[model samples]
Target: MLRAAVIGAGHIAKQHLAAIDAAPGVEAVGVCDLSAALAELTAERFGVTAWETDFRRLLADCRPDAVHITTPAATHLAIAKECLEAGSHVFVEKPIATSLEDLERLAAVAESSGRWLVEDHNYLFNDDVQQLLRLHREGRFGDVLHVEVQVDLPLFAPGSRFVDRHAPHPAMREPLGAVSDFLTHLSYLANAFVGPIRSASCQCRRDSPVATGAISEFKALVDAAFGTALLGVSTGGEIDRFRIRVDGSRLSAEVNLFEVGAILTRTRGGPKPLIPIRNMVGRGFSELRNARRSLSRKLSGGPGPYEGLWRLVAEFYARCDRGEAPPVSLDAIREVGRWVDVITHAACDNATVSERQPEAVGP
Candidate 1:
């Protein structure tokens, strides 16, 4: 079995921990966090005897085949480099690095050290996203032309951590606030469908008092490969929602990433009567099917919402066992980071970001 360890004890890290537990042919050998109590608790719960309050000690003790860096986005580059130097493949959680330059440096380390640096674009493994890929590859959505994405969060949700003023939220303290944490996800999704972003104009604003100078809403207009893309993010919604729409010369499709379903419509000169049938077959069917399965999974003891996380973790270990490169190329990850950095700079009223937190970027 491939040996693995996680180095964070946050909510998201918990997801990774569970995924590692469920992953076949992989043993969670250790866990570490800055918080001693938290690290010990997590280790004990996972049946991992090697728990350390200090990350350096954890590395020295376990030296697992892979180190899952589930820490904050800002710490990714530095922690990942250390793991690589210590002779471990690194699986980092998203927002690879806060800036383009930092991302490039990590790329260099990966090249020089010959260790894989994989970022968790976990959403890419979602069933809906997988289906979207199939449709694209099968030419179901012929000649993709344009794209639209919407990411909304319900900040007012009764127990949301977003409203916790005392909590050290990575998004709230990052260079671009919420934008820093979210743009990577959106940018990568754009690249997956529309290709490299050639040019873009992005805007952000604080829409609520709880935002603490962090932007609560953002919008971007981007010129991508096939055509253009309009992307948006906002808070204080009644419910969380994430949706992406791809318009092609032959057909158009929409996927609700949050709802875990997709819908499609043919645009390439279909008869009026056939349009309704196509809607029933494509749009209505996916929603009904996904909803039923989602409910069933929740009812069962399966990895409920973050099934994609489990799949990605399992695949990362599988690749490690096979001595193969990561599924997402380092170049592709760098390109996505570049897109996010450019968009963040543009959205911040062209004010040069002269500095980031020392811990946020790698050397």
Candidate 2:
């Protein structure tokens, strides 16, 4: 069995630990956190024998085949490089790296080390996402013409939407806040169906009260193989919804990533009365499929529903087991990173443009 270690003990780290335990042919060798208490607690909960506050010691002692870096975006590069140099494969949380330079640098080290460096772009592995891709492949949605992604999550309680003193979300005050952390998911999902982006335009605003000087709402326009799509994100939304709509040549589809639901409709180029009947039939089939997936997740005793954390971890270890290249390509990582840079530049005022451009960086 391959051994695995988790470096960060944040909210996301728990998911990694659990997935590691459930993954076949993989064992949770140890866990490391900045806080000794947290590290010990997590290790005990997972029945792991090793736990330490010092990451350097954890790597030297545990000698794991793979390391999952679930720390914040800021510390990913350093920890990942250390893990790679220590002769361990790396399973990292996303956005890969915040800046283009850091991503390129990490890609460089990871390559030279001859190790697998995979990112937890987990939602793309969800059953809902897979079904959507299947529909496109089956010619149900002939030629994705255009698509739009709308992600809405409430950042605070109903009474307090915004405040300068007490920011609702920890990310509000951070450099890009949710823009960098959450939007990356949407961007990658867009790539799954929309194809590679050509150009992008971004707009951000403070939609709530108080003078926090944080951007709580934003939108991006991307020109891509699916033509163009409007990407929307609102932290002040009343409803917590993660949905993307694709307008294709033959049919249109609305998919909810969080709930693992999808609805496809064939509207245009069809007779007036027949369209309603067709949509009714389509909705029935969609509901049936969603119900089956939800039930399967509940009984499978795997990681939680539609999260796909378990599936992603399993795939990463499988690659490590076979001594193969990373499942996700570095080119795809660079494309997503490049678009994020462009959007953040266009959103913020007086943002410094990067002198170095993104290139193909991998082993």
Candidate 3:
């Protein structure tokens, strides 16, 4: 069994631990956190012998085969670099690093160490999204014309600990605002369907709770090789929700995160037909209960979303074991980071971007 160490005992870390426990050929051997109490509690639950407040000590003593860094964004680069140097594969939470430079450096370290590095972009591993990608690839949506993505969330809610004080604090605020956090997921979708983004224009705003609360909204016209794409994100309002629409000839697919599944509309020169993708069944409280039960199964060592991510992780590890190329190369990730920089710069400047290109559908 490949031994693994989990750093960071926060809410997300629990999910990581659950995933590690469920993942085949892997065992959780160590747990580390800034809080010794938290580490001890998690270790006791997992029945691991190693528990410490210092990650350095855990790395040295445990000598785990892999390390999962779920700590704050600011500390990712340092911890990842250390783990790579120590000859352990690294799996880092999303927004790999704040700056493009740090991302490149980490990539270099992984390359030199002959170890694997995987970013935890959870949406990329979602089964529903993967099905959408397959449909796009199969030309179910003819010659992609335009794309729209919107993700919104209210900051102050009971389960909004994911968007709590740490959210407004410097550590969380500086690395990335709501745009980067949400766009990391959206970027993968845009690239998967519309192809690479050549250029972009965006607008952003921040509000304080006392004064209508801090909010960031952005609209970007992304230039894709095949066509053009659009992405918009807003936070600090209403409950959590997202919608993605891809319009094409003959058929268009719309997916709302608030909804269970995607809707496909087709026009064949005569009439429009609505086709519902029945991948997700049930609705109302039943739907919520089913979702919770599915998640619970995954968390309790059964197969689920985390299993998919673990499979990807295992694929990377397998590549390393065989001395083969990683499934997701560093160059591809760098390309994603470059686009991230572009969108962030545009948002900060509130710039309008336009490019002369092939005629594409848009608002």
Candidate 4:
């Protein structure tokens, strides 16, 4: 069995641990966290052999073949470097690094150490997304016209970690604050569907009283070589949701990331008046199918929440065993990192200019 360990036993850390446990041919050797209680609790739940407060000690004692870093973004660079140099593959959470320079450095280290450094863009492996990719590959979806991706999270909800004042989340320290946190997902999803973003424009604002100075709403329009994409990130919605809609030359499809199904629409070949009716019937059928699938999963307790994360972990382990490249290549990481920088920087710059503007005076 391949020995695996985890660091930073926070909320998401549990998911990483669970994925590690579920993956075949992998064993959770240890877990580490700044808070001994959190680490111990997580280790106990996962049935890990050991828990530590210091990662270096875990490295020495457990001697894992791979390390999963579920810590804050600020600490990812250092932790990943140490793991890679220690001869352990590193699997880190999204936005592996906030800056392009840091991504380059990590890539170099991974190359030198002959270890794989994979980021957790697990949404790419989501069931809905996988189905969409399969459709595209099967020649069912034609040339892409545009893509829209939206993620609305409850960052400012009653007990959200982001709203904690004493020890604010690392995302709150980012240039765009909490809004920048979800942009990493948007960047990769858009790049995957619409292609590389050539240029971009953004609109951002800070309107949530609960969120204080963080940007609570953001939207962007990016131009890619072949098409364009519209992306939105917000913390204002009552329902936390993630969804994507792809418009292609031949048909259009929409997938709700929170759910496990997709709806595809295309031209209906029938009488003019019946075309609309046929389209409506098609959508109804799709919804019924989705409802059935969702219910089945719920009843069977099969692939519950974060199914993509589980799939990603399994695939990563399989690739490592076969001596293959990671799911997200170095070049792909660099591309996503570059776009993330562009979008976040643009939003921050816009916020700065807005802050500097003088208020309207009585005329």
List per-prediction Cα lDDT, in the order shown.
0.79, 0.77, 0.70, 0.83
Q: Estimate each model's TM-score.
A: 0.91, 0.88, 0.81, 0.93
The sequence of per-residue lDDT tens digits that candidate 1 reaches over residues 140-163 is 888888888888886534455655
The 10 consecutive residues of candidate 2 with the worst lDDT sum are 161-170
Ranking by lDDT: 4, 1, 2, 3
Mind giving the per-residue lDDT tens digits that candidate 2 earns over 62-146? 9999999988777889999999999998888986787778898998897898877777778877777778878878978888888
Show where candidate 2 strays beyond 4 Å.
158-170, 267-272, 284-302, 349-356, 359-363
TM-score winner among the candidates? 4
Better of 2 and 3 by TM-score: 2
For candidate 1, the per-residue lDDT at 155 reads: 56
Model 1 lDDT at residue 159: 54
lDDT of 2 at 57: 98
| Ranked by TM-score, top first | 4, 1, 2, 3
Q: How many residue pairs clash in each candidate?
A: 0, 0, 5, 0
Best by lDDT: 4
On a 0 to 100 scale, what is the lDDT of residue 233 in model 3? 73
